[model samples]
Target: MGHGGQRDPSEYRKITAEVFYDISRRKNGVRPCPGQGFPTDIKIECSKEIRDYPVGTKVRLDVVETDKEGSRPFLYSSYKWEHEVVE
Candidate 1:
């Protein structure tokens, strides 16, 4: 079961991505999800909170399940940048 009593809800997983551009006042950038399992480029929306991080910084993104039929993983709101990728 998923949210709101929905059956077979989408599963969420966090992935590490790199900041392609500066996330300052422009509020527009891109974070590419690098890996063999999940290779996709997610657009970056710089909120007031995450405007400090610079380019080449690795951030975590909570991605939804992409294997399900007709599922849209890119539509998920994964803008919570807390932990930095050490490696």
Candidate 2:
């Protein structure tokens, strides 16, 4: 017996950011409207990679924040997550 009445284990995927301060809350899918979205929160130790992605960089978050939440393996079909960064 569970509280949420049992979620379909098959349909759920755990997301984790590497070297996180704290794994308090974990989200499954996070997307933006008409754009690519971060499927999960980020916890990257390499700030350089995070920094190099300057404005106008159409980037796909292919890194893992934690072992639990492996990466957003799939891409969103509706919205193109490419960012047109402004200087």
Candidate 3:
């Protein structure tokens, strides 16, 4: 089973061999930590997986790893966070 298929989104700090990022209107981006400043502000509003992130929990999702395409290696931890009951 895949991570999102079998693994529960509430019991682990999900990390994968993947990464994806996109700049808003500029060519460069200053990724702010989900709970930190602009850009990286953790906004899970309207998302179930994200809206579930409890205050203080760290979470990221939908990262696209594209090294074969031609870009360098990088990660964007700007998915969503939720409180997971660590079993």
lDDT of 1 by residue, 1-87 (tens): 123323243454556656555445354354556681454554444343443556666666544533237854442323443445533
**Candidate 2 lDDT, tens digit per residue, 1-87?**
121323353432222222222335342232222222344333332333423543333333323222336653432211211223222
Q: Using TM-score, give the best candidate's number.
A: 1
lDDT value, candidate 2, whole model: 0.30
Q: What local lDDT score does residue 46 receive in model 3, on the 0 to 100 scale?
A: 20
Candidate 1's C-alpha runs over 4 A off are 1-10, 22-28, 44-48, 65-75, 78-87
Better model by TM-score: candidate 2 vs candidate 3 = 3
Off by over 4 Å in 2: 1-43, 47-50, 67-87
- What lDDT would each prediction earn against the true structure? 0.47, 0.30, 0.32
Instruction: Write out the backbone clash pairs for model 2.
Output: 15-69, 16-66, 16-69, 17-65, 17-66, 18-65, 18-66, 36-81, 56-85
On lDDT, the candidate that comes out on top is 1
Q: What are the per-residue Cα lDDT tens digits for candidate 3 across 3-86?
A: 343434443333311111334532222222433323343222223343343433443333322123575444333334322222
Q: Global lDDT for candidate 3? A: 0.32
**Candidate 3, poorest ten consecutive residues by summed lDDT:** 13-22
Better of 2 and 3 by lDDT: 3
Error of 2 at 29 (Å): 20
- For model 1, which pairs clash? none
